[model samples]
Target: MDDVSSDKHPDRGGTRRILLAGPRSFCAGVERAIEIVERALQAHGAPVYVRKQIVHNISVVEDLAARGAVFVEELDEVPDGATVVFSAHGVSPAVREEAARRGLDVLDGTCPLVSKVHAKARRFADRGDTVVFVGHAGHEEVEGTLGEAPESMVLVETAEDVRRLTPEDAERVSYLTQTTLAVDETTEVLGALRERFPLLHEPPSEDICYATTNRQLALDAVVAESDLVLVVGSANSSNSVRLVELSQRQGTPAKLIDRAAEIRTEWLEGVRTVGLTAGASAPPALVDEVVAALGELGPVEVEERRITDETMHFELPSALRGTAGSRTSGGQS
Candidate 1:
């Protein structure tokens, strides 16, 4: 991570001010998910099989892998009766059934918020309403949610998709969304849905998780004042990518980098104030490394712009609750 060289940006010698977004990285759900793996390792020993990446961050996955958590794409990879932890993104009912058939000791890491959305899908579909799901296609979270009521649900990625929808009964339609999404764009899609289906039943509350919402709201406070914005997260992270897009939508040049070494010298040219933020799944240590590397290039002044304080906390799964090293914290776990 110490690949940042001062010689690369010699011409840009000055005090670089970095505005850090508060409530940026490691949300409560992510914390809970990670702790589940760690405690499982302690309770059940090494080689604890995990169904997915757990969360979207590569660093978190790699760290857990080093500590004996084996991540697999499917249940077949695990030996029968071995311990398996589900990723934070809820699994479909079919996946649950498969795990049960394998007789695996399952430890569910699904975020409470995502579980709520899944329950809504079942309820809406049972009521004979066609559920319109709003989220990106091919995403694991979307796939899991859609599976809850596949026959009774349809997915729409944009306002145009909503326009093209021709349900069996247009009047008997309800809508749900993936937990991670761009808030503004979702609103636009919802507006189009309302125009097309005046009686479209909406979710009881916003589907977008509080951590994702807080990170975006915090970034909004600093993006306009920044010459460039850098979001720290892996490419596959939907919430992290959305942060970069949010800055770009506001006419500011933004880039997504997993670490400080990925920062380009050209981005620093004539740039003074830089806005720094991390996705909900990213580790805070990565953010610290970025700031330290930036300081090595020249003087750095870091100011944290806090829009709101996030005190949300999720409890660990019951299977690992009483295990050693299972303590929780108010901050990132």
Candidate 2:
């Protein structure tokens, strides 16, 4: 971890500054979730069983791992009565009940936005509408959304998935999406849904949040102007991975780095204009360290390319009943 130290800047004097990414770091949901984990680690100590990547970034998981958090994919992997976190992507009702049945101290990190989609999917299915969920199959978000009405919701990853799906009740069909999905991808899926089911019912509120859309737009705007873009996130982070793909899709070569140490000097060869952005679960400190590393390589000039402002906040779950505080340092949604 010392590899990402500020000393990597190589300046004789002090740290070099760069234009930081706006709307970078922890959203409200991420903050609360991280807080939940930290509090559990502090209060409980050692081997807190997190059912999935708490928020997707590998660095975050590693950091927590060092602090004695144990990540598991299923409840069976955890011993009975162990403390567990459900992940920011949310989980099915069955998972919730299972966690309870095992007597686990459960702290759900499900994003409110995702929970909304789950609710909508369940409601749409209850209305007897053949629900078409637009998202990558097997994704945790999609799984949670599908769980809302698994009996009725049909999974579709691409436009072709929509075209091929033969809904049981086409006339009364409805659609929802995974929160962290790419805007263009969802648009393509939505377009196909429209063509296949002309009377398809759209959700009252768009499942994708403002943060995801804005980040992608910002990257698209910067990619054309930059020589190479460095995405500040982990490979496991879906949002971070998408940022790399988005830059590539925009014709800009990009790389995903969990820390400044991961940045290969070779990728910097002959590249002057470097764009840097972080995934929802990535910490701002890691982004700063990357810029510091770049300053060592050359005279760096940082610029912020922002598509919009983000001021949204989700309240802490009332299960604590507001008696406790919920806040985390930094990362994405």
Candidate 3:
């Protein structure tokens, strides 16, 4: 199941307790990206080549691989004219052009929010503005967005990094951010950029996706009451990593795990309440497995704390909409 519930079941009894974040796991953008791959598989058949991990979650990639989705590092590895998917992190215009040149059938799984950041960077370059893109260096999304206007854009990962920057045009400056960044940390970096360039122009709208903000906010509350926090997600997942950092910033102990087996027994020592949440790309099954593992240690009670309601949904790529009916197996549905 894509969604998870923290509600305590009547059949279960335990002194240990689990507090689940309501808005945790499988956000709309991740949902849409996963759906794109599944629908493409249904419409085009197996052996669909994905240029990268469809999303950051290993479970998702492994699951898709089990269903005949071949993961590749580059376009040349894919047979010419075969179908390929771009990851949800988005890609550079160069990569898109290259795919066209290769005569490959391409399905972009880039999140719409990420596409918006790319568009904003292009616009800033067109206006002759030096764009300061605040994000981790070498991340897929950062690489993609930077590729949009590399000559006009400078990448900064921290407040100090921003201070070291010497853009060609300080007076004509604009800023954009990666969508999956930790909200509070990104805000602080943005604050520093503002201090440096008081005339800094902001993106057309908030670049951080609503799901990232909501999950961080919900995790804030989860941290307050938890003896220890465990974020269920792959280490490579950006949003999942942020949730762990957000908890640590709150002075709470937190660990990032891909599954239940990674949960250390020593961490559970003297802990009565554990807060559990998964990244946007993480599946609810991982959360369930963690809860079951906790129960094995002792009696357990499950409780859900929903900070905000997320009713947001992204539309499928127009090319796959006709095959939407066959998309019954994976994604958030």
Candidate 4:
């Protein structure tokens, strides 16, 4: 069975230790995304086919499915004239065209920041500038961004990847990034691009999401003293996977899990100090439950590392827009 959200369970007895990672879990984009889908479900009724997981969380996706939301990979998979909502991860113009071609009642849930990257890509392409997208290959967000200008901008997953791309006009090169990438990794990739292109224009604003940057920073602080780091996120979540990578990159042992059941005894072996964090699409309540489960394991102290605060937000599409509260920012449910 797929691991869905963890509900209330009787307190299990372990060491009774839980170390909460500050700035963990959902960012404004994801929080607002869940609200959008739930609101659409409440407002429009069943048979709402989402083009992809609204976010990367498996439990969240399953929860939405249980609530009558259907997940599909492409617009073609959706029946004609069905109500379909796009995921927070942006899609390409081609997808939109196909959705329109299929005559689906589309509600775009793409994050505003991601839309910004798309807009930048279009503008760069229009100006005859070679655009370079810095992000991991095969990620949904990267795929969407690549759709913007497949023939123009090259996808560079690393700084090393950037060096190999030989644009016809180095002086007229520009770049955009995937919103959920690690801040440090993006910086190195951008550095490499600059070194090679010498003069590449970047998007007016950074593409990495504000919540992703903040959560990673908090991990850097809290993971320093912990013997083991547990990142509470689904395997598919890009930001969650990066948190695990972030810890491991720092030479710390980290584990990524959908919930507590995946937690192993050996992960805590010789681990007196354990650090806990989650991905952007993850829910804080799940993190809380994980902490509680760990508390049963042994005596544990919880600490909140105060990192930079988040105030970023995105608006739903004009069609979905209303005089609603700004749910797109670091707004939580």
Candidate 5:
């Protein structure tokens, strides 16, 4: 990690400052998922087959790949009876059954929060409730959650979609959401649903995860004082992409990059104060790299503006607990 202290530094046009967002990098769920893969690799040895990218970050996948984590697009590619781990995004019941059928030693790295969504969906379906789920259509999280109650759940991506939905039993309808959706947009869709069905049921708690909500809130503060925002993450990460969109919507120029190399010099032509943040699945090391690159442009100053302190952590799955990685930090794991 970059050890540069948060101090003011001057540039040509104005003070060249970077407003770093706290709670910007890996969340507890992401940490737990990555640790699962690391522990599985240590316990079982190299060439461990992973069903998908352990998390959405390319660098994270690359790091594990170097350590012999074999990522495949599907279970079929994995040899029969080989040990396989699932991604942070939960998989469907069908996936679990298929793994069992193949005789693979399965170690699920799915975030516990995602697993909660699956359980809620299944419960709603069991009670004959038509579940209206809000999220991107093809997201892995959505795919897995939908699989829990395919026949009972209806997916809506926009407020207009909510208007068009016709649940089989209008009176017996409930709603769930993907954990990484933009809070404001989800609210608009939920509002539309409420108007149509006065008694619409909501999840026992907010469906959107706390980390996503906190990061967006932090971005709100960053954009307020930043001329340009650099969100460090990959394209496929829903929460990462949402951070870029949220900044753009707030009228601040923002770009999503997987690493420091993608930050174009043109974007920084006249920028003074830049906002630095990362997706939930991203590592702080990526943010450090970007900060180092920015320093090469000219003298750079960093100020960490925190929205909240995060003490939340998810324990490793029971099957893997009390093992070698019992107390490993996210970075070391």
Candidate 6:
């Protein structure tokens, strides 16, 4: 841990300490997704219709919207022959078919990691194996992955859900997961699946994205030393919500906020030490805004707890290659 002190607050009596978790905020997939949209806007100009929010963060969505990206819930809303970009959360093949039918130009912004899960789903289905996918029921990513092999896949959000599963072929069971799930809870669910299916086949690699795991591991360390943990992310963000749940499970109070303005003064009433982190889709600037917000209340000393350094990078789509603009200011890691 390295302590970096801000200037003392002259009006405040006591100093408040903040434990900032490293590897927080925008991950590589998010960066690639956002940049894809940016490059599209630069190339195609305004009225670039996007199928959904390129990423979950409101700030990122609003920023793109301001730059003239029109977000639609489905393909029907977009006019025929217009260019469209998919969200960072992968979309189903049905959506791709719809776009193709309409003759709409398409640019896929789905995270490579998520695309990997889709491939696994197809492979498992092809092998006549039942894929028991671990994820939230309504999440965009879950919905997309489920669409890959809806007939062959079953979604389970909890260990209890696992108990209720009765695959046609019990022995031919395989598992995959959403990339942004709580590490510890997923483990518990996996344990239950193992108990039920001794021969349960696991993915060749961990399904959860490295960024999500790194953020959770980093938050776990900060939550131990924090009186209150504040996670910077949108409500719709799965990994962001999981960070708050993880903190509460560890016997610490935590809150999820999209921005500093949402931070309730009551949350800081008696909090002497604060743990701050951002979700994979959240903008890094939001985290800095939170630190400044804490400073306004009193003197704050910031310490960073870095569990591991993240250096992952995903390239832009082949179509957008070499057309990329300067990278965003805040570092992806």
Global Cα RMSD, each model: 4.6, 6.0, 4.9, 6.6, 4.3, 4.0
Ranking by TM-score: 6, 1, 5, 3, 4, 2
Task: Give the whole-model CA lDDT for all candidates, comma-separated.
Answer: 0.89, 0.77, 0.86, 0.80, 0.88, 0.90
Model 4 residue 224 CA deviation (Å) reads 0.8
Per-residue lDDT of model 2, residues 1-333, tens digit only: 112233433332332324344566556667667777877776677888898888877777888888899999999999998888888899998899888898988878888888888888888888899988877767888787787778898888888777788877779998888887888877888998898899989999888776677678777766765557888887766777888898888777889888899989888664556778888778777887887788887666666766677778776555543444434454222
Runs of candidate 4 with Cα error greater than 4 angstroms are 1-18, 318-333
lDDT winner between candidates 2 and 6? 6
lDDT of 1: 0.89
Candidate 5 structure quality by residue, lDDT tens digits, 1-333? 111132322444544788998879899899888898889888989989998788998988998898889999899999998999999998999999999999999999989889999999999999999999999999999999999989999999999998998888789999999999999888899999999999888788988999999999988877866778999989999999999999988878899999899989998876778999999988888888889999998888888889899999888878788778642323410
Off by over 4 Å in 2: 1-21, 319-333
Please give, for residues 152-239, the per-residue lDDT of candidate 1 as tens digits. Answer: 9999999999999999999999999888899998999999999999998998899999999999999999987787899999999999
Q: How far in Å is the alpha carbon of 330 misplaced in model 3?
A: 6.4
Best by lDDT: 6
TM-score of 2: 0.88
Give the local distance difference test score of model 6.
0.90
Q: In model 1, state the lDDT of residue 185.
A: 88
How well is each residue in 57-114 modelled by candidate 3, as lDDT tens digits?
A: 9888998899889999878899989999999999999999999999999999999889
Superior candidate under TM-score, 1 versus 3: 1
TM-score of 4: 0.89
